[model samples]
Target: MGSPNEMVYIVDDDSTVCDALSSLLRANGKNVRLFSSGAEFLSFERGDVGACLILDLRMPGMDGLEVQKLVSNQASIPVIFVTGQGNVPSTVRAMKGGAVDFLTKPIDEAVLLAAVEHALEKDRIARCEALQQADLLARYHLLTPREREVLPLLVSGLLNKQAAWELGITEYTVQIHRGNIMRKMKADSFARLVKLAGKLKS
Candidate 1:
């Protein structure tokens, strides 16, 4: 079972399979949502909260691979394929297309649960990193042009005097710019400033 904020999306044309999987997941205190087709699943708007998709490989119209293609741009939501007609080529294709796991039907309950847990945890981690990156970029954007100029030099291990010389400004002016950078970035110390700068560069 995952946190209340997490969700598991099941997309399969088979009513029996959808009902069974939904029952199993909800029995274990998980939040489950079901769709009868890949097109319906794709049309649904999902929240940014942690979520993963369990999709069937074969369907009437849009299949698992096609849905994977449509949703590939959404890097945060991972997918796991549950298919009765699994083959070597399809498994390879699913993995290559960035599915988190592939399970043949007559799906093992324990294995399916484990894969769901793993995918949800992965989504949590990716979302956390994305938030941190956005915060770093926002802080970086707050810097004055001169403060921005001073940041890379400080990260590169340049002394205030050397940075001042390079920018053709007084050392005192460089110190002011450095102070402003630190305050605006909310960096507690020199090491923290360096770390934020490294994140921006990466």
Candidate 2:
């Protein structure tokens, strides 16, 4: 189930289509916004929430694929395309562009709801992972200069003596830095520290 704050953006030139989508999504406890054009949808600044886009493939000005390309670079809301013409090329392009699903009209209420659920869930997972990476980065920034210097070498399989030799420091000093790194990074074990190191490097 989605929160009441979770939004569904319906972008279509057809007023009737947008009205129908907004009604369906609102009835299922989702916040809905209707846009008459791709440009109008792009202009709206979305809040930080697990949201998805319902886009019409054909439009007078900027088409669905065009909007998708621009949105991918910015908003990154998951998309479910509803088109009267569900052609092969368009479907392949939308999928490759990271659309959640491509639906054909007359849209089945059940199928659209299922796609919306999947898209929202996917967005939530992505946002959660992003938050974790940000938290890890914050911890990494808390290390002192010497501790930072020692971290990579230790995680790279160097013993304290080896790391000390490489950095022209005493082995005891290296051991101290290692302890500090573990404490600052909140790593329960050396293995966990190594895993954190990998994420930072990547």
Candidate 3:
């Protein structure tokens, strides 16, 4: 599903840095939200917005890394860490914890813009995949027990006759179940059904 708006959330205790980054992002045609602390950022309603977090790693309470972990559990919003200290261990830790980019202080406008764009695109793609998965689950819920049993074999590339034999059912019955599965899934072709089955497997 597509979000109603795209926002770039800036979480930095430094008011000057927050204002500057907000101005720069707004000038570059992005919607921006500024939070003075990690706590403020965390408290916002998150799922409806298409956004990435620009977080300063050295905040006083609820530091950036902690915030990243919190957001990681809440949603798949991409994060770009901004740090004045630029310690290697912290950078590595942030990266390992799924921060999309680690940026240093005195941020380069071009690099920052590029990072924001990349994070937003990544979030968009992830949200789309999540939506697809939800749709797949809903379709799967509509399947009958027999259809569910036949689906795995069909997806294993078994022919109707083979699947029928394997399941100890008549070929006509297998065909009927297969037709029901295809209709329920809204899958127009066997290849599409296989793809859906692969998603379920994963």
Candidate 4:
């Protein structure tokens, strides 16, 4: 699950549009942070949490595309483009730039809400995968040298006798190291251990 404080950041120079969208989201039990411009939004600190950005495409100074580039470099924040007058070229640019959804104003409440939900869910899954990868790395780091040496062969479906022979150890010692590997990795089964190793490989 994402942090309870996770928000839908709304960046629009229009005060009315920002307020309306903020209120709409807040009414549906979503946390919101309203920013008057792209520059203002870029100043905020980000973390490994799930949230989406609703940005006006034609904002003054740094536009939405520029904001998307900046945010993409800093974190994997999904963007939704909102514009009063969207052109084909601009919409194409935003989509190619990794905007999850492009919305034109006056926004439909249901459509906007649905898009936000989808973006938030995507962010949630991404954050979870990142956390899982980090945990796997930490577990991998905890393995002893012998256990580490055994892991590749174990994940390759090697039997205890084969792994023992390959490592110049007895089958009994191979079994012992395998147990330690499983414990350190918090892996319950051979399949789980293989999956963890695959993630580490990636």
Clash count for candidate 3 is 0
Tens digits of per-residue lDDT for model 1, 121-161: 88888889999999889989999988999999988999999
Instruction: State which candidate has the highest TM-score.
Output: 2
Cα RMSD (Å) between model 4 and the true structure? 2.4
Residue 92 of model 4: what lDDT? Answer: 91
How many Å off is the CA of 79 in candidate 2? Answer: 0.9
lDDT of 3 at 113: 94
Cα-based TM-score, every candidate: 0.93, 0.96, 0.93, 0.88
Tell me the lDDT of model 3 at 57.
Answer: 98
Global local distance difference test of model 3? 0.92
Worst 10 residues of 2 by lDDT: 1-10
> Of the candidates numbered 2 and 4, which has the greater lDDT value?
2
Candidate 2 Cα misplacement greater than 4 A, ranges: none
Report lDDT (CA) for all predictions: 0.91, 0.93, 0.92, 0.90
lDDT of 2 by residue, 73-181 (tens): 9967899999998899999999999999999999999999999999999988988888999999999999998899999899889999999999999999999899989
Model 4 weakest 10-residue run by lDDT: 1-10
Q: Give the TM-score of candidate 2.
A: 0.96
Residue 16 in model 2: lDDT: 91
Model 1, residue 2: C-alpha shift (Å)? 3.6
lDDT of the structure predicted as candidate 2: 0.93
